[model samples]
Target: MGPSLAAPIEFSATDVNGKVHQLSEERGKWVFINIWATWCPPCRKELPELAAFARAHRNDPIRIWGLSVDTEQSPDEIALFAQSFDLSYPIFKVDPTSLRIFGNIPGIPTTFLINPSGEIVARHVGGVTGADLMRMIQRNQSNK
Candidate 1:
């Protein structure tokens, strides 16, 4: 789903490691933002692929962020979960209200693919494959 954001979605959240990351600071890179939760099955299944997507495209200007929307879990717990899966992307336990920056996220496992220009070009409301991500990012680049 493609919806031109009324304005470039901007957010700043602390990563599990305690480093603050901001969307606006990530200029010139394709920001892959995934809103997930520890208890979400789809999110669990998609984590590895998102990590792989980030690894496979390491040479590209892609920055994948795994934002955990698990209100019940502490950052330490979420970080432990990510560590168990060996997820390589930056992981953060974020507030559910952070979803409003993009739009009304119907549920967990919502992901937004923002292009280098800071425009959200694609979104997936469920589990997504690495191939799907590759194609979409490639197609987005080709269009420009």
Candidate 2:
């Protein structure tokens, strides 16, 4: 709920393809790093909208990534889940130790909005509506 616009955090995680993707490479774009688990209700509910947003703004400099924190799910299962949602953006299988470095994730469906300069702009810890996401993008544009 606090304003974390100036706080900086570098996210280091690999994509589904197993290639390492660093936040340093995602500069000059507003990256929506959505943290979710397979079993969370709100995570499941809002994921489709997230996918649609990514697809709709394919040409935009915005990148949405779904980071699954589930330790029990395999890569194939995660791929199937991504396919089921028709997800357009990248979905990464994150290590629990990696996640723990970010924060104590006691809940599911947490989101972090990173600006073009790789700074954490905002943090949403629950279900986010499509309108809410749209407004975030609009705000990011306005800042530019």
Candidate 3:
């Protein structure tokens, strides 16, 4: 199942670099908001693929943001984790318990795909590959 669209979800969060990123600000592009954790095995495995996907689409109208739901870790710790993976995309530390904007995050490694219009078009509960993401975008684009 996918997100229940109840008017485009909006949120503002500060990334590890102290940069404020808002979902509304990315309205004109495809946005991937991935909720992950530092200790999750699948999250660790998918970081590189998400990073590569972000790099490959750097010039495109696509954006990927990683939200680390590691309540036990500090910002510096999360930053270090991202750095170790060579992840260049924006990473934010968020408390999963307080993240009501996206509804219940049943598990880690959950990814939400938001369309250019700001509506969530898809949601995946496990690790995903770059190819899988691209295919999703392509399919959505074709449907439009």
Candidate 4:
């Protein structure tokens, strides 16, 4: 995972709490955009680590955003999933078509690391660990 990635297409969606969250607001911080679905096993496996990453880097200027791609799942379902992992960050129902904005996401648990300037820096298309995540953040911070 390195630099020279494309800029993410700007988008926003309602968080689990029914509040509108915008991608543009994530500027000036290291943002982790995780594209996932409830039915994906790998996605489920990665949630806890994502949550841990959120907590571990709380003081840092970093944000982890989960984009659930479930077509028919309600906010309650998403809430339950987030609760199961005891997620400290927010989850949003991003439109399936929105994945096109980042290029074709061929798998679940896809993750994109967007720098403070809103440019994507790296991507992981499978399970990831909290340690690995921490390393990515550190790398970004060092680059900045």
- Cα-based lDDT for every prediction: 0.82, 0.79, 0.87, 0.82
Scanning candidate 3 in windows of ten residues, the lowest lDDT window is: 1-10
By lDDT, highest first, what's the ranking? 3, 1, 4, 2
Q: Model 4 over residues 1-144: C-alpha lDDT tens digits? A: 233465544767889889888879988888888999989999989888888889998898889989999889998888888888898888987778866766657688888888887777777889888887777777776544
Tell me how candidate 4 scores on lDDT.
Answer: 0.82
| Per-candidate count of clashing residue pairs (backbone under 3 Å) | 0, 0, 0, 0
lDDT of 3 by residue, 1-144 (tens): 434664687888999889999999998899999999999999999999999999999999999999998989999999998999999999999877546777767898999888888877777899999998987788677432
TM-score of 2: 0.85
Clashing pairs in 2: none
Residue 98's lDDT in candidate 2: 77
Q: Can you list the residue pairs that collide in candidate 4?
A: none
Candidate 3 accuracy as TM-score? 0.92
- Cα shift from native, residue 123, model 4 (Å): 0.7
Query: Which digits, one per residue and each the tens of the lDDT, describe model 2 over residues 13-92?
Result: 77766777788788898888888988889999998889888888799888888899888998779878988999988889
Global local distance difference test of model 3? 0.87
